[model samples]
Target: MSPKRPIKPGASNTSPDTPFNLPDVGPPALHRLPLNIAPQGEGRIPVDHLRTPVQSPPSHHAPLEIVDLPAETHITSVVVHAPIEHFFLAPNQLSRLPAPNALSGIRELGTQKHFVDLQEGGTVLLGIDSENHFRARLNSDSRPSGPRLERVEGTLTWRVKPSDESVGGSDSRLTLKRLRNPDDGPQEVVAPKRSSTSTGDGWSDPWKKWDSPPQQSSIDGIEVDGTRFLLLPRGTDPDHPIVYIKNPEHRVYDFDYMERILGTDLMQQPRGAIRVPPANQWEVDPNLPFQYPLKQYIATYFPLLSDTSLNKVARHQFGLANDGDMATDVGLTRLRQTFNDWKRGNSTPHPPLADPLLMLPTLATSISGSGLSRTLELPTLTPEGSLQRLDFDLTRQEWDYFKTTHSGADLKRLMASILNRQGYDVFTPTPSHYSPALVFRRKNHSFVFFISLHRVSKGRTIHQPLNSGPDAADARLNTQVGYPALQEMLQAHAENRLVWLKGGSQVHNSQSDSIFIVRDNDSRLGTLANL
Candidate 1:
């Protein structure tokens, strides 16, 4: 029980997982091209340079059939169709989209919020990327709205090349020798080949190979800048903490220079260093109970949130090289199971309430000084208006309509009423497109007020045959009127526009009566005393 020692300034304990902004050195260039397609023998063309053609191509005969076209006849071709995809936005999930900032690659188009285009081109991109949210319009043609979101049009190509170290290739370094425009942000710097030359403020080096095992600080190896040095903490090696530097920048702190400056033994340490495991460490057996304690187990095995080694380990041990695909449903399931096992928990929770703050009930204990509650308990609704779980399904259209129409104050009042009458309390957060429900109890009876929002569709329409049955026409008409009204009422009530569905008779006699239509200005609305 001693005070934790503070890391001395200039001391080397930098974790390997530190975010390294390495410069791009690979020859893969980002070029902006026109969306127009080129015919045989035509090279790629820039979009902005392209212009409308003066004349049309001859459709009668092929130029290939004849050796050459008549010199006297001027060949003219008009752009038949433009490659519209470049203009169209690419569809990607809202969650995957980076935060709206400089690094996100999405830039605002105008004054409108949530409307943006990709920086590469005029691709109209979605605001947020949660689940496959990118939709780009390649051309001027607009896509029809539907439940499934639309994406922008663009060809996103990614190539994964073998790392130079993995392939036994020399570390091909590219020194950003000189910058034509150093002050210009993100200006291209051309470094022809590998060598040590000073650039502006720091150095640039290519990312390391894929499979290169992290080296220990004490081990000897070839140096980047040909300088010699050794790792610190002297003979017995008692105090020097091993640090890992993945994706090191050679120009800023050239590996060799660091060794020379710090002293050959300790200065030239590996970018990533781990304490060499005990000479005869026990092998971990999956079947046997783990001997390593939980705290040590997590640090050594589970990798902390800030550990960069996790990236390398994931790539090697689990084939999880890419962060993008790690959160998939299958991956999430595996992660959940691992977390459960690590915590020694027997049960796993479901997707939890869509919006916990908004959906939970309000009680005297629920509210705080800041008007926030930590938990909400709701009664389970029955399927047949009996004792079942209360939930609702909604179509995209209905959801949109409700969000546009309602307010939070209206929703709170409605919840207050339901809780008093049916023994249920509701906690609605901010307005959203999701459907909300109420679950409450009465004397020896539990009821769930389930509200579902759906689009008007043929299948949902009640069938009414001509002269087939007397009640058929009335029933169909009644349903047609009641369903839409019901949707309208629910939305209004949810939004706080209306408080209660009132009728003179306790039980509704007419369709309108049975369904409490909103009376906006009824001064005689029930107080808590009535319930």
Candidate 2:
């Protein structure tokens, strides 16, 4: 094409011979583009643009911001049955309890490191006085070592008072107060105390009451104060005493405050309880399935295998022995029957079998040289190697001897062990004597067994000559006591009065009067009672 002249701004390069005269029109506002001058020897081309930079509409939602509040301390209390003098004045004894300094992840104060700075009628530790309303102190000893380290000091205050629950009023209540604050030390402030008359008639004597204080003492320390304090009572020995410990600074960080102060593990765990070993640490072989014999299962579930007597018996009974030689044959048969009954539609009337495993060697007939038969006699022997008749019944003397030696607890333990082997979760609740019920739970099924040993009456009628038979004796005993006992257990289970057996089926002795098992079934009672 021939060379064309450059068009000026706002001018159009159109021929005058065009069919129609058209007006010049600038770029639409929506498609407007900014102009910039090009440098010499540089050329720029104009491109049609439609999108323009527009600010996004302000968001209707606000940005989330989290603000942490300062940690606040609280006062907690526990009552223990122990002598107040032994708990507070005896430094060696108090050191054995759980203290804040002994907690993990916190600095450990050495043994005998804390001293009882006894204030008038109160105790002070780490600059916190017991007489004040303060409950905690930021422990300085636990503070990390650094220039920016926050010097946190944890202080504990304790008071000793008489306890009426103690035998002959010998036990005392040791009220403990824990405090935590950013201040350098505990502040002295007067806390209002409830008058003896205002509290209650039972609490009129401040020293006798476990909760109320006798009087308010003048506190001399910092000016800041806390609203709550943990009061712990010392009534009995450390083994069975009640103690409470909690972290008031739970909002900021989680920790056991009492464990740190007492320098002992105060977590309420079962006696002889063992932590489950890691999966890798277990002796289970990868090639074999995780299954064990009944005896081994019991030993694994309970920590009783450590006992020398029980360990030997368990090994002999179930380890390498065949099924027929197992000592728990009677218990196993009963358990199997119960399971089978449950599987079937049988609701009740499933009485356990008699002692089928108990057998004695009898004399056999011998043949003479010609064909004449001769009677052979062999000495009768008992399971314990005693020279007694196989069918010999327990005499009054023997029964008395056994009763004097064996305890109800032994029976409870035996029943629990048997139930545990059957895959039942067992729990022994506190104040067990009141209910004396053992709980067994599995899946959605739960039951309670109230075990009691009834003394056999010599005058009771025995239809079967088998004096050693548990069934005959149990039947006679049941007629006298078993039914009544069953009724009581049913009532307790129905009322939910028993703590451990609450909300579960009641099981009574299906066969033996000495042992009662309750299955968790509400409708089965009528059937059971009729049976």
Candidate 3:
């Protein structure tokens, strides 16, 4: 049977007709036996003279065997240092990086995108082999005018599985973990990359090649010659199978512009510097679609999903590293005192995917490390590509409100003004024909936002589309002639066009594009640019 489509308001599926099928009790004759009648009245037939025999319990010859749990399994681990920006922005998908050749001397299976749950910090790592546990630290020295570098530690027993389309082949997963932060020591700076040539040209913001390699390395290191991008000694990750190169690039260069170099801290996890496998060994590409194995896995094959599921896989909770389920104190704890901090909520432990509210604090912390807040401009995707935040003004929420207000030319101009602030060339066509369609053009992107205002109930604070009861048609429409004709007119330029039916209730529609609007809290879009 075909599944039902979305039901319109006031529609009913329950029918007034009686059901054709009914219970069967073999007519009035089987209703009751003679002496089997209820105590209230005697309808008298004795019915069966003999009763069925009861089944006896099993004898000693046929005893039941007790079931028991099998032997315990140990979790193996390995740490990955990832920068914070790439974890959150732009073509924000984790690359399907293959597993290390050998983790702590054990040959383990590898999966693609080992770091999808790397939401907050680089402190997490792969699970450990029961035989060998890996422990390492990146202890940085206290510099003048700098706060004590709180030792960033690794998370424990991370088991990450990828979706079918994940770069690491279908249904493959990785188990990883990082070292603990309990160790105390003076700044322990490991050796730098063998050559500064790694960062001489266009900077390798997130990942860089250190010793230029014998030019190649592989997951198995077998017949795969010229396998692409030899691994860099991912800084001071003690649990790293090999720390051939100390730092990917100069520590000073990492915060140059996060996402562009501005995302995570140089050393630790949970904002830890990620291991970027550049196309070659010497330099890393700071942009997406950079190279093989580490390129972004855009979800093109999947059908348009409801707004909620847009980020379901990339941001859903995998087995968290801090659930504290394991008995042994092998990860980030000493004295064997492990509690489910996430459940108790004593403190905010790292969640598999960082929510926007949680992201506020971390981003602010990263910004503090970045002296570039001097311009107060936010990093736009590429090199020096940034939003001029000093004078430009527009929180995405306000832009949405003004776009749907429908207040003649002033409303149109205000929408245009918001786009202009972000350096877009905004234009309002005559008649504002797209239910007041506004054209926004910037760089290579040209977008026509077909905005429709959502309706709200009289006393309720909630917003909605296509109001129900007594006033359904009273709700404003998408446009006078509606979307079909409008869509046909702009079909040639369909790629750049968009639907802005407000985020309130309109976002629930499966076809509406899901966008991340920076909330108004942080000095209001002046800090977090939507560009």
Candidate 4:
């Protein structure tokens, strides 16, 4: 016999005359559970044995506050706005840039932009708009600069997926913790590609190479700026993986302009300066003094370091030296350390720590180093390109080993143990009452969990669409309807109830598009508390 359908309040199923009624949960709660559906009494009809209609709650008992949702809530829609401008400084060019002053009405600009001096301090301008437009003197520096103004507008649409699609053959291996439908359509996979590969000649942003080899079939894209741009999977491609221009009418030169606007002298420098060269080749060094750190380097030299790429000069010129003794490089090390401190919220804006470019590599290195494991084992399907089948049973010893390795150290030891025994990966963003998450990702799908610590009422709410963009509509529907339905299903399964509990959720709003699962009820209290 076919499995009986689960009842969801207020949800309109496709089947005609379906007996289920959409439950009137309560008011619009952001990031919290919306329903107050009580547990069925002992005399209540078993879902499968049901014959009578499900009764609706009275007009009262609605919640006053929003209940937070499980960490696994998948956000479906997101909107991102990027302001990019680009320009090429010729023998003669002059223009003013948007002035930024944080002390007064000019606060932080959303995702700041920079004015790059392509040449060595060769650019010049004498004006900026503060509370009012005023003449400002450009600082003298070793790097070249030029006067130029370039503008471009665009929007970016992106999605994150599990595994590097290109590296993990279609039929890779998967360490299954949950059973899901096999034919649930093609799962989105992230195809990893090496962005900057030096072919012994020079550094290559493969995505930019006109004749770049296609690393993976899955790495694809649509024409947005009148050109076909391939989207490489994150962690594998350039730091900014999802890139495209909204206006195709503008020439590709605009992309160059945008590139100049986004590129910071701090991030890009002559490759030779950063790495040591072979015996046969000439080292690309501009021989600039003390290689002023990125902040001071950009400020003094290419004061417009935040703007664009400098000359294709030498190694020392760019301060990208590989002397292997950064430990003693006072100028370089100090700049890197200052930036690291700022990114970690350890310190405020100090005189020398204004620009982040100076300390970026160190900051990123720190984040990468903060993890518990030296190597993380991601589940694969088959070594070849094909869908993988579960060979190991949940009770088997192999499954236990897989669990302990993947589950990191956290407060929920019992849950961690159970999860390991079950062959699942568990994690939480922030662990506390006000914190809204306890997620799980298995076989590339996400699941989110929400719990009410207090039987009387304490809990969090899940907001819909999960974004604060202009495009989101009636925030209540996405958060209220979508989240509760999925959460209720996952919560039911965690209680050991036998019912259909499918895949996981995606968090649309995070620096890294994180995969998650729902975990409800604090495991510390041995028994399942009253819902």
TM-score to native of every candidate shown: 0.18, 0.18, 0.23, 0.17
Which rank order by TM-score, best down to worst?
3, 2, 1, 4
Rank candidates, lDDT, best first. Answer: 1, 2, 4, 3
Candidate 2 lDDT score at position 517: 26
Per-residue lDDT for 336 in model 4?
37
Off by over 4 Å in 2: 1-449, 452-484, 493-531
- Model 4 per-residue lDDT at 481: 27
Number of clashing pairs per prediction, in order: 67, 61, 43, 71
Cα error, candidate 3, residue 138 (Å): 21
Candidate 1 vs 3: which has more TM-score: 3
Q: What is the Å distance of residue 450 in model 1 from its true position? A: 8.4
Stretches off by above 4 angstroms in model 1 are: 1-89, 92-169, 175-178, 181-524
Better of 1 and 4 by lDDT: 1
Location of the lowest summed lDDT over 10 successive residues in candidate 4: 25-34
| Model 4 lDDT per residue over 1-531, tens place | 101111110112123443222111111110101112223321111111111112234333322221343344332211111101101212112223333233221212244323322111222222243323222122331111211122111211111112122322232222111122345454333222232211211111111222212452234443322334332222222332122211122222221332232232211211111112232221122221121223222222222221212221111222332122221223232333333332232442332133221222210011124332121111222223221111111234533443344232222333334434333444432333221223333322223333211111111122211123324422321232244443543464475431211112122332211121222223222212311
The global C-alpha lDDT for each of the candidates, from Candidate 1 onward, is 0.25, 0.25, 0.24, 0.24
Quick one: RMSD of model 2?
35.3
lDDT of 1 by residue, 1-531 (tens): 101111111222233454321111111111112222333211222212111111233223211112333344322221122222222322222223334444443444454333333322223433322344443322222331111123233423211111122212333432322222334356343433433322211100111221123453334322322222222212122332332322222222332233232221121122323332333211111110111111222232222211222222222211121123222223222332333333332232321111111122222113234433221222222222211112222245533544454543333334435334322333332233322222222222112222212221212121111233444533432342234434443454455533322111112223111111111112122211122
- The model with the greater TM-score, 2 or 3, is 3
Task: Write the residue-wise lDDT of candidate 2 on 1-531 in tens digits.
Answer: 101111111112233443221121111000001111111111111111111122233323222221332233222222221111111222222334344332221222465233332211111122223333212122332321111111223433222222233323223222222222335276333232222111111111111112112232131111102222222221232232212211222111011221122222111100011112332111101110101122222232222222332233333332122233322222222333333343332332322121100111222334344542232222222134421111212235533444554444444455555556444455553223221234334332223333222222232111111123434543433442344544544565676532221111111233111221211222221322332
